[model samples]
Target chain A: MIGRDEVLHVARLARLALAEEEIEPMARELSAVLEHVERIGELDLDGVQPTSHVVASSSKVDVTRALRPDEPRPCLPREVALAQAPAVSDGGFLVPSPQA
Target chain B: MSAEVLALSAAQASAAIGAGELDAGELFSFYRERAEADREAGQEGLNCFTWVAREAPGKAGTRVRETVPHWPDTVRMHESAGSSLAGVPLAVKDLFCTEDAPSQSGSRMLEGYTPPYTASAVARLREAGAPLLAKTNQDEFAMGSSTENSAFGPTLNPWDRTRVPGGSSGGSAAAVAAGLAPWALGTDTGGSIRQPASLCGVVGLKPTYGSVSRYGMIAFASSLDQAGPLTRDVTDAALMLAHMIGRDACDATSLAHPQQIALPSAERLDGVRIGVPAELEPEGSSIEDGVRRCFHRALALAEELGAQVNTDISLPHAPYGLSAYYILAPAEASSNLARFDGVRYGLRAASSSKVEGATDLLDMYTRTRHDGFGREVKRRIMLGTYALSSGYYEAYYGRAQKVRTKIAEDFATAFASVDLIATPTSPGVAFALGEKTADPWSMYLSDYFTVPMSLAGIPAISIPCGLSDEHARAGANGAEANGSGLPVGLQLAGPAFSENKLLDAAHALERAIAFDSTAAHV
Candidate 1:
């Protein structure tokens, strides 16, 4: 079973804040899922390469498709882009200072 | 007239509009009115849509036409000149970003967030004259098997409100099934589109990975993510796909579609070699008897249609697909969802705790995510983080990728002698809401039959084959039981980029099955 400290550690790594009551249940559920997925370790996969993307291995696609020219095309205007930002400064995103 | 319009398939409706039998404006209004009625109907409604547009883009009274009249006219001319879905309004899963519409992706994290641009797939469909009618709800970040993970609320099944419309594309499937929208777009990572389509008794096609550009789709599992249509029939699915596919400059992974998506009309599956993998119904497995019966019956029907049925095919690694998928998908999800940090867009929450400096930023992120994400999303993020951590990376994530390759190779070996592989789209029909939510493993098992094809990145479709023998409880609130059983879906998967042939086979099976889509009423 995955322990509370382990779950808390994972939450910190994933940058999630768990509630006081959520930790135990999260650990239990995570342990259950991990146990199920651990069965994949039984496979004799020696020397087998991992497949990150299937299209790269697909035979139908051309390997040497031409890349788009580095021409500046119409894009979302800066103001429009900044419109969705939670906190905006003068023409850019505003954030807390990095230093103490 | 309203009933007749609602009854028409998307293809038939498009043709009617072209022949002047249906007015595009009036047709759009008709669907909009029904969708609004359904949305407002309280418990009787299938809360499918997250946002419904008042008017289609480029139509009169909208800003698009007000600024550019000739542009709307040009679009109209193109529509009349025979775009596949001529002016048929479309319902999109909220994951596809639409400019100026709240594409929240069914999460509080993005509540009230509108994108500045439209998805490549949505834009292409719109260019083909299928205007945006509404944005449908989905599981938050398209993570959950059932739509219960939607932070807004679960989208109830149109067939039986007591049951879940399988998700994360449940709202798209429910919308199409209930006639809330003529057709809809849904993304399938691990059976999101097909499972929901199966549960709702509609047709869903998950095209080969990268066949349809994923430019504006909210990322879930990038390598496995694919966008496809959830329609009422195979022909309508074919029509929607024809316009949605092509290589796009914006998405490097996308490739040019090899063949045109023809509206399949073949009534026989002659010269087709179908393989039924032994892993589909292993001893003591969760495959429900009703679903298994329907699957075997569909195979029998395929044989009657002159197809060679080979039952000896074995995908030994397929049983491990669900395990590998859970690892790979969430690992990718953890990386993809890192952009949701409380900085640029979406929801931002201040930390409740007093912290100094960089810790303040960290606290803000944790608090925002904790407050923003639903339980399932949080669970996945945690699981993914654990799997990809320094020590566990090779044991979990790396091994899962190798298993994924093995599953793909299994399919390749099976496909060497078979034209198509068939399985039940899901273990069973639409399950009751909250039935599996308490057990995440059970929920994960819901994709048992559908995940292998997804792992292979092959084209697969779910078409309604028959209804289950087990009837919905009498007088399930919001929908009349009518003594009819829930819908069961038969999945047909083919090798990479075999959408045309797969559709042809599904179309043939669809006709032979003769499943009544309108049997269940909301």
Candidate 2:
């Protein structure tokens, strides 16, 4: 079973601050799903190549074909890009200092 | 007039507009009013839409010139002028970015976030003269099997108010089923579109991965996430898919769909080889009795329609699909969702005493995500992070990918003899809201029959097979009479890029089954 410390460790790795009340339940739920997922370990799949993506043989264009000329095209204007940011500085997104 | 308009399929409505029998504006308004009424019905409402566009009377077929920049210049003007859907407004899943609407993706993190440009798929559809009707709700980050994960609140099923509309595309399925919109767009990671479509008794298609461009689609699991259609019928699904597919410069994984999504006209599945995978419904499996009964009945109907039904098929690795998917999807999700930090667009947690030692950038990110994400999203993020972290990567994520390879090989082997494979879209019909919410594994199992296709990146379409027997009996007895029973979906999955063949088979089965879509309860 995945314990509370492990859950908290994963949460920290994921950059999610778990509330004091949510930790225990999160641990329980994680353990439950992990139990189900751990069944994959039962399969003896040695020398089988991993498939990260499935590109159909019948597809006319593969990943390489999706590329156009690497020329600059019209993009979201600076104002439009910054408009949705919760905190914006002069022309960029504002974030807390790393060492603050 | 309103009833007649609502009853018309999206393709029929589009044709009517072209023939001058129906005004585009009138059709749009009709659906908008129904949707609004349904939304306002309180306890009786479906609560499908996250944001409904304001009434745009005569602006139905009027092209939004601003979106033209997003469209590829080559073939844009011609396709826009002469497309199948001539100004039939579309209901979009909130996951797809639309410049005109808030694309929150059903998460508090992006509560009011709107993109500067529309998604390639939505923009293409809009260019085909299908106006944006509304942005439908979904599970937060398209995580949950049921729409209960939506921070906006769960979208109730149109057929039975107490039951869920299977999700993360629940709102799209519910909207189409309830006659709120003629059609809608949905994304499938692991049966987000098909499962919901099955539950709501609508038609959904998850096109081959990369068939429809994923540009501007909020990433869930990049390899698995595919945008597709949820419509009332196979013809409408084809119409939507025709306009939504093609190669896009913005998404590297996007590809040119090999076949034109022709409006399927096949009424008989003559000589079509269909395989019923033994892995789907082995004894002691979770397949519900009612769902299994409907599935067998659909197979029998397929035989009657002259299809060669081959029951001896084994996708041995398919049962492990759910396990692999949980690992792969969340692992990808962990990486994809890292962009949701407080620095950029979206909710930024206020630096307050609530955030313990909230001085640094790390504290801000942690606090923001904690406050922003729902329980399911956080759970997935944590799971993904754990799997991909040191010491666990090889055991969890690496092995999962190899298992995925095996599942894909299984499909390849099965497809060698059979043209298409069939399964029940889900284990059962929509369950009651909160029924499986307490058990995440049970909720994940809701996608049991549908995940393998997603894993193999093949095309699968879910069409209404019939209703669950229990619900049918209840309706018959007038205990909870609604003329319609809970929907059961029959899934037809074909080899990669076999959409044409898959749609044809589904269209044939759909015609033979003739499942009534009218939800009287809504």
Error of 2 at B167 (Å): 0.2
For model 2 the local lDDT of residue B94 reads: 96
Interface RMSD of 2: 3.2
The TM-score of predicted model 2 comes to: 0.95
Across residues B25-122, which tens digit of lDDT does each residue of candidate 2 receive? 88888888877776676335678988887886366646554633553642242233235678899999999988867999999999989787778788
**Candidate 1 per-residue lDDT over residues B1-522, each given as its tens digit:** 888998888998999998999988998998888787776764467889888887645552232311111211222211222255678999999999888788998999999998877777887788777888988989999998889999878998877788889999999999998888999999999999999999999999999987788888999999999999999999899899888887776777887767767778789999999998888753235788889889899999999999999989999999889899999999999999999987889987755323334456777788889988889889888889999999999999999988988888888899999999999999988998899999998888889888889998999999999988875543456445666678899999999889989999999999999987766544
In order, how many clashes per candidate? 0, 0
Best by DockQ: 2
lDDT, residue B66, candidate 1: 16
Q: List the residue pairs that clash in candidate 2.
A: none
Cα deviation of B152, candidate 1, in Å: 1.2
Interface RMSD to the true structure, each candidate:
4.0, 3.2
